[model samples]
Each structure stands twice: as structure tokens, then as C-alpha cells.
Target: MGREFIAYIPGQKDINGQFTKANLGRTLGLLKKLLKGGLYEFGTLTAAYNGWAKGSPEYDQWMAEVAVYPTTAQNVIRDAVVNALTHVKGSNDDPIPLTIVWEGGPEGVTSRYEAAGPSWTVTITGYPPPAKSMLAERRDKKPS
Candidate 1:
């Protein structure tokens, strides 16, 4: 069976330090692509796929709601991602920093993962993405 999970991408701020419509749109678009692919990996971990909650009205509702209000939608998404991550044997350890990418522009956010009952969820808190050096260190050094 495919594992189910939700990924929350925070809206990037504009020049006035506000989350404008464009930022929200980009975040939503990224989320949509993530959901459609249904798979991801962190660091050296093998690939993992998202699971389906199967006949869950709340799950269905939450999925529908995420695109409209990113902030309010975090809790629901966190539940799903946590549930899915639980199925994996190991954790990413440094989930937030590790997930951030430093290519082109900044995809800034701190990811918070939580697991409860049969749900897995992740929340993306707005922050700067990792610096190039930090990412390089993460890639070069072994976990201690």
C-alpha cells in the first residue's frame, strides 16, 4: 500500500515583508506538484512514497482546504506527513535544515514533523533556507 503524507510549504514574503498573493501561489503550486508525485527522500535515505488515508472525510476535507489557507492548513498536513514518515525505519534527524535547498532562489522554511495515532504530518515554518556551506557539510560528513 502507498503511504500517505502532507508537506506544508510556507509562503515566501514579498519586498514589504508580507506574504503576498504571488508567494502563496508559488507555495501552493509546489505543494500540488509534491502531492502529485507522492514520493521524496532526505539525504542518503531511499525513496519513500505517500500513503492514502482511505475513506477519511477529514483527510479529504483537509486536502481540499490546504490550497486556500496555507497557515490554517498546517495542522492537517502535519498529521498526514507524520503518519507517513512513521512507516520509515529511520528519521531524517535534521529535517528542517536538510530539506531546504539553496539553488536559484531561496526556498526558505523550517519543517516540523509530528506523528499521532495513524497520521503523519509536516509543518513548514517560514525561515531562511540553509546556506551553501551547511548543505555541503551535511553532504560530506557522517551523522554523529
Candidate 2:
């Protein structure tokens, strides 16, 4: 089974201080460019819009699914996220928040700008759940 992770990247704003689709695209593009040659593979990229109906929200975000080897370490994932954020933010002072959630569990990393510079928090409290067995599922199902 392939281990897939999701990257949630906040959208950037334009000169007018507004979150435009163009800016969001640019942000995703930059992230993709920076994440190249990493220890993982890119899946698909999508946009997530958080509006009033969804609750209190500021702007939309981009979601990218990344597939990594089962043996990949948490540090490797954290480094990829940090590198992407560093390149995307560039000289911009605004803080860019990026999060990567591993499949099967809550293990993940959250990257953000701090007073000392870029920083990331890793959470690996538990191991990922084992993959479901097809035979087990078949046995549980009743024959028609």
C-alpha cells in the first residue's frame, strides 16, 4: 500500500491585500517547483475555499497530495515542507502556514514563520493503522 500525505498551504495575497485565484495558483506553483526532487511523489493539487458558511475563515488554501515510501522518516517530510515554505515566501515578510498530514493517522507537520525564522512542529504520537485486508472484508460481507 502506498503511503499518501496531504499538504495544506495557505493562499497568498496580491498587492491590494486580497486573496485572488491568480495568487493562489502562483503559490501552488512555487510550492510544486520547490518540492521537486524530494523523497516523495506528487499526487494531485486542489483548492479549498473556506467561507462564512463553513465558519470564521479568512482565505482559501491549496491542497496537494504527496505519496511517500512507507519507510520515509518524519524529518524528511518536515524538511520538504520547510524548504517549500522558504522558497515560496522568498523576501515576503508575511507568514506562510503549511501543514502535511500523514495518511491513516494524525501524524503530521505544521510549518510556519516564527520570530527566529521558519519553524515546523511534528506530531508522531502513534503508528499508522495497518492496511485493511481484502480477505477479511470479503469474509465479513454476506453472500447474496
Q: What is the number of backbone collisions in each predicted candidate, taken in the order shown?
A: 16, 0
The total number of steric clashes, by the backbone 3 Å criterion, in model 2 comes to 0
Badly placed stretches (over 4 Å) of model 2 are 1-71, 88-90, 105-126, 129-144
Model 1 poorest 10 in a row by lDDT: 41-50
Q: lDDT scores for all predictions?
A: 0.30, 0.33
Q: What is the C-alpha lDDT profile of model 1 across 1-144, one tens digit per residue?
A: 112222221212111111122233333233334443453212101111112243454344334433343443333443333333323335532111112222243322233433333222233444332233322333456666
Model 2 TM-score on a 0 to 1 scale: 0.21
Q: List the residue pairs that clash in candidate 2.
A: none
lDDT of 2 by residue, 1-144 (tens): 121111112222211121233344454454454355652232222222221121212212111112332335545544544354444455663323443333445544433434453434333333442223223343456586
Candidate 2's C-alpha lDDT? 0.33
User: Which residue runs of candidate 1 sit more than 4 Å off their true CA positions?
Assistant: 1-52, 68-108, 112-144
> What is the RMSD of candidate 2?
15.5
